[model samples]
Target: MTPITTFFRNLEAKCCASCGQVISEQAESYATECYTCQDQASTDAYKHYYKKN
Candidate 1:
């Protein structure tokens, strides 16, 4: 409602490290990436880890 409140809220906003997207407020405070990027990274890692020679 107030400008100061809005400013402080914006300060809490975070960006994803991999996709340059805004991280949701619901995400962990220490998260470095958005959920989408995190999910993609997890999928990639799973694929790589399970890949058969």
Candidate 2:
């Protein structure tokens, strides 16, 4: 690949909002967190919601 292409690709790369992990280019456009962080957040939310009931 040309240097210009590489530069543009890196320039457009996205990172996880929570952990700063580099997000995969193939990931969904609306995803803001990495899979690991997403899973942890889901688990925490589940526990918190259930504990209140």
Backbone N/Cα/C clashes per model: 0, 0
lDDT of 2 by residue, 1-53 (tens): 57965666666568999999998865337889989999999999999999999
> What would you estimate as the lDDT of candidate 1?
0.78
Candidate 1's displacement at residue 37, Å, is: 0.5
Candidate 1 minimal-lDDT segment of 10 residues: 4-13
Worst 10 residues of 2 by lDDT: 4-13
Model 1 deviation from the true structure expressed as Cα RMSD, one decimal place: 4.3
* Local accuracy of candidate 1 as per-residue lDDT tens digits, 4-53: 75666667557888988887665337789888888999999999989953
- Considering only N, C-alpha and C atoms within 3 Å, which residue pairs clash in candidate 1? none
At residue 43, what lDDT does model 2 achieve?
100
Return the lDDT, model 1, position 38.
88
